[model samples]
Target: MSTMLQWPASRPARPGDPLVDSFGRVHSDLRVSLTDRCSLRCTYCMPEQGNLWLERSTLLDAAEIEAIARVAALDGVDTFRLTGGEPLLRRDLAEIVRRLAALTVGGRPVEVSMTTNGIGLAGRIDELAAAGLSRVNISLDTVRADRFAELTKRDRLADVLDGIRAAAASGLRPLKLNTVAMRGVNDDELHDLVDLAVEHGAELRFIEQMPLDAGHTWDRSTMLTRDEILETLSARWRLTEVDGRGDSPAERFHLDGGPHTVGVIAAVTAPFCGACNRLRLTADGQVRNCLFARDELDLRRVLRSELSGTERDAALDSVLRASVLGKQAGHGIDDPEFLQPGRGMNAIGG
Candidate 1:
């Protein structure tokens, strides 16, 4: 384990200097949460009831989100992934995407994508795509409705299935499906989930369930691992590694040496902190350096401040740079003293 170290204060960010952390990872990809509200309660994510939703008044408006994004855009961010309890639940999602899509940095149009639960996606995908959504990552844990209803405390599996088909037909390239691999929950349906992806022209990503549950009941000993997922896959096909893992969390592979592939995000077993280039902005406007970070920089407070435009921009840069510079070498989930973030994944943005 690497000892945690604090970086020296970063000077005001310049156009080319970018948001570089102590490990020399230039932060450009931003995960912006539109809201912490969702349409379904996935067993692995949210509680079935009693989630303390952020007040409407406290949430950042579209204009405020755009302004903060513009600052980050000017700094170096070119890719923004929209996340949420379910991004589709945000009423102004299309408008938000439109505004983000219009942002450009270094003469390159910013790429805007979303990670959604695919509940209400079918109804708004066309407008979102027209507004410049590059693609989407839809979460689908099981192909069977009974298991889906059991996993997600909702019997709306058919709705998600329809949404996936519509998104596939919406001309969104590389449509992806995210599945949190659980031990006794949906582990038996791994092959079935991948087959569902093949049927719908989507790539399946088996994520190692991290300790991000709202109920804080995640157990690493019982949680599914990447090697275990591959063991399940290797049962029926010959696996071939795909090159260019980049800074992506998923280690992708070709199954049966064909186009169909599976991505395993072994976040716990294999820490990829060295190549991480992403930062997160909570729905309420807090800048989180990592998904599991204990500390955050309040951008909403900065936005609500009385600083002039130039001053506010300077302040945003300083806070954003500070968040990056203060990043720990890894998430430290394996450390003896490791503690889960105070906020769950839904609250943190993804």
Candidate 2:
């Protein structure tokens, strides 16, 4: 598909006019992919080899990322999450965090967070926290060392565990663990994963695997649903649904009693399209309104154009507004005619 090209000559978007889509859902969260290179080759996330990687010259630099983020913040985006195939792969990651930390929206400081595999996080958690990283969501599917090696094609389970401890010690509050439950894979270890979370004082969330895998062979029959997860957990612990979840994707529950909680993201079974409030910027600078969106607006072109600073910022604002205006009602994963996106989860910045 061709990128959106029309640009408005107006000034930057006003704070009064938030980034709202056609469905009237105002977006305040922006997810930015720093790079597409990763250390681990997870079976579910990518192929074992022959994976295509973006050239460093094509990616948005730290300055460009900060500029785009500033534009988004000026439009009332209050939350920014850095993501990637593995964000730590970027050498300038700490610098990026420090730059984004200086951003604010509507007189409030912007919240900066990251979604990482936690392989290289242990040694840098202190530096990252000092750079203004507020929280981290680590992706860990199984607790068994053998299972971890089999699933990710890496023997970094010990590294990840140490990273979790380092994160806690570094004062990354409300640490979160994300697990993708696949039937007959790691589904049998749900309780064990929860126990690990409780032990570390981190909230664990089970996510229904979507069709974003590199294999493109995701079958609904083999997938585990949210109801089944709750059924299994309820057998072991008393789970009380927490009220007022707001726009967050996770449906939270208290474990046994107060002070400990778990969450489930039923993206396929229980869609939260009406309340969806997020926009994504690919590392190569394409703007995506939905994870399954086939269309993209090329903001990188604007950033690289010969336009003046004012003109470039104005063009970026126009592209951002147009992208949000074109947001779809839902990802359409449950629709009979649904098709998986061409890009894998790693490329799309999960």
Query: Evaluated with lDDT, which candidate comes out highest?
Result: 1
Model 1 misplacement above 4 A: 1-16
Residues 29-99 of candidate 2: C-alpha lDDT, one tens digit per residue: 89999988888888878987999888889899999999899989887888889999899888899999999
How high is the lDDT of residue 180 in model 1?
Answer: 94
lDDT of 1 at 133: 98
Per-prediction RMSD in angstroms? 3.0, 4.3
Over 4 Å off, model 2: 1-16
| Clash pairs, model 2 backbone | none
Worst 10 residues of 1 by lDDT: 1-10
Residue-by-residue lDDT tens digits, candidate 1, 1-350: 11223335675445435787777678889999988888888877889898998888878988989988998998788999999978888889999999999999989899999999898889999999999999999999998889888888899999998899999999897899999998888899999999999888888999999999888888887789889999999998788999888888888899899798889998999878887888999999999999899899999999998996889888888888889889998999989998888888888887
Model 1 clashing residue pairs (backbone): none
Task: Score every model by TM-score.
Answer: 0.95, 0.95
